[model samples]
Target: MLAGQRQSAILEMIAGSGSVRVATLVEEFGVSDMTVRRDLETLARRGLIAKVHGGATLVDGGSTEEPGFVTKSGRQAAEKEAIARHAATMVAPGSAIALSAGTTTWTLARHLVGVPGLTVVTNSIPVSDVFHQFGRPDQTVVVVGGVRTPSNALVGPVAVAALQTLNVDMLVLGVHGMSPRVGFTTPNLLEAETDLALVRAARRLVVVADHTKWGLIGISTIARLEDAGTLIVDSGLSREAREELSEHIDNLVVVEPSASGN
Candidate 1:
């Protein structure tokens, strides 16, 4: 196969399966290891796929499936780290915060370790595990009980009921997509419902998303643009998209990867 044909096939494979190993690609395309690596390099440069230790995974934006933790962790490592660091600075010590589930929120959970007197309410198993490992005695971690989704997020009626009973200082949310019309959305209906409950329970709704999520659309709309108290994104976003988002949301905080200490 020609290089262009091989690359197109590789993208099709990732689109269908979410990831592809280097060896697998080589065997499938009947190409040398170097050729497969070069193809992956080109795709990664275009932000179509993320290069992993031994393979490549499709980037998170516009994914059809709710990606597994391993897949997500492999993609957008630098962006997530930058977002986490900036998000951590926004948390006041001793605040009761509600965090939604996603790779970005998981990164934020890592930075929350040293934050003293924090009460974190979440439905993500990974977020709960982060606190279980390093949370201080003064800090409290509450995991909402519910059915687990493919993304390892707890959702359904139980999670929504739990969130409705509590009030939080801030809600840290991640979106599958963001647009002026849709605001924030998720592919899963149950997850969207749980997110809505969290939005209602918090005094301030803060959305943390990377640039890739800007133009995509999900199946369920969680909140309108006017509902967010603040929207935080990376500097990779286009100026036009940023201006459009800022016009609808009250406070828009765009943090650069360097300034965020990623």
Candidate 2:
């Protein structure tokens, strides 16, 4: 298998358990000890794993720590729903759109199911599943090809290749974190690469993120702050943050969770 695919498999194993020994990886992949160590070293550099004396362990509570979809789906329920609700209104009927992998984007997919004659491209398994269960007959859903992350996002070189062949009217993205310096970021390096491809495949970009995403930094950046054509955030964001974001994003929208009705 290719290096990227091998690395993705290694991350999956680490995610399933907690750590992987160099000897175990060598045996599992039929590769040399040096190759396995190189994989671990690459992952460690990205902050995705912690290197021990003879093995690698998962990273938690830092820039590279990525929570599973189930663990994150329940967080900031109201805020995410509010952002999704408002973001749904930005879509026009029959428009081709790309939805990045995230809980908020899955929620937005639910909202888009009824829109007539629309086409949706996504790398998120859960987001595509939403449409599979509820999409109208006139709608089309394209599932990008790649390795699955803990968040159920399909990302890697395969996903990037798929995205390069398609163009969409808009890209509705959800990020792990955002800041002035690093802009939009993700904990997974492969995910970041795939997201950047999605950004390039679209004409307009709309970012949907809750207030808590502010100030946190991830291992890799997907885009700069000014890259987003529109950014929809919840009112829980501080007044100072709103001002700071508005300076970069021309269309910065803040919705009150209570007032934003589904």
Candidate 3:
């Protein structure tokens, strides 16, 4: 196919999903990876798409746009680790906690492995796997059931139902985005519902997000600004942002990336 035709097709794919992976395009067009990258470069130059870490997204990838887990996981690795490290200190050993699915919360799960005799409930397959791979015998992990999304979060009725019966000491939640108006939000409607159920199941809510998540909005709102008991973010957050978030959230913890010892 012609270069223009291939670029057009790529745009169509991105339009359908709000984002597209280069590997998927390479396979679809039977082209070299380098060739696909050049095409993406051209399209990005045209201001039709924004180049992301692993792929491209609509330049205006709005409130409903959500990238896949792998695509988002590597975007802010150090900052997420720092945020996760601070969040781990908030959970006591032998307490029950729910980890909502997202890259940041998954990072937090790994940090909690050494905390003994804890009960973990999670809708994230990766989060559960981290414990299964390294958790002590005293640690119990309960995997919630539901349809999984590109973010690797189990959502829908099954996941919501599972959260209803459980009461956790704290919920270390992850969100797609948050805004002064929209609060904490997720792109998938079902995930929003599942996260809400999680909010209700926990005695306290702690949100872990890097600076990049602020000022953004998603399709569904999981909670309001004051809902979180504590909010942990990386040092990349601006002073203005910290002051603003501090006013709404009770305890806003910001940690430098180097302190995480990653």
List candidate 2 segments past 4 Å from native: 1-60, 259-262
- Candidate 3: residue pairs that collide: none
Model 2 lDDT per residue over 1-262, tens place:
8888899999998776555667779889999999998998899899998765456656647788899999778767777888898999989999999999999999889889999999999999999999999999999999999999999999999999999999999999999989898999999999999999999999999999987677768999999999999999987676778898999999999998774244
Q: Give one digit per residue, the lDDT tens place, for model 1 in 179-248.
A: 7767788888899999999999999999998776775568889999889988888766667778888889
User: What would the per-residue lDDT of candidate 3 be over residues 114-209, giving only the tens digit for each residue?
Assistant: 999899999999999999998889999999999999999999999998899999999999998777788999988999999999999999999888
Candidate 2 at residue 26, lDDT? 87
Model 3 per-residue lDDT at 201: 97
- Please report the candidate that would top lDDT against the real structure: 2
Comparison by TM-score, 1 against 3, better one: 3
TM-score sort, best first: 3, 1, 2
Off by over 4 Å in 3: 1-60, 259-261
Candidate 1 residue-wise lDDT at 131: 92
- Which parts of model 1 are misplaced by more than 4 Å? 1-64, 258-261
TM-score of 1: 0.77
Tell me the whole-model lDDT of each prediction, alpha carbons only: 0.84, 0.89, 0.86
The alpha-carbon deviation from the true structure for residue 108 of candidate 1, after best TM-score superposition, in angstroms, is: 0.6
- Give each prediction's root-mean-square deviation over alpha carbons: 7.7, 13.9, 8.8
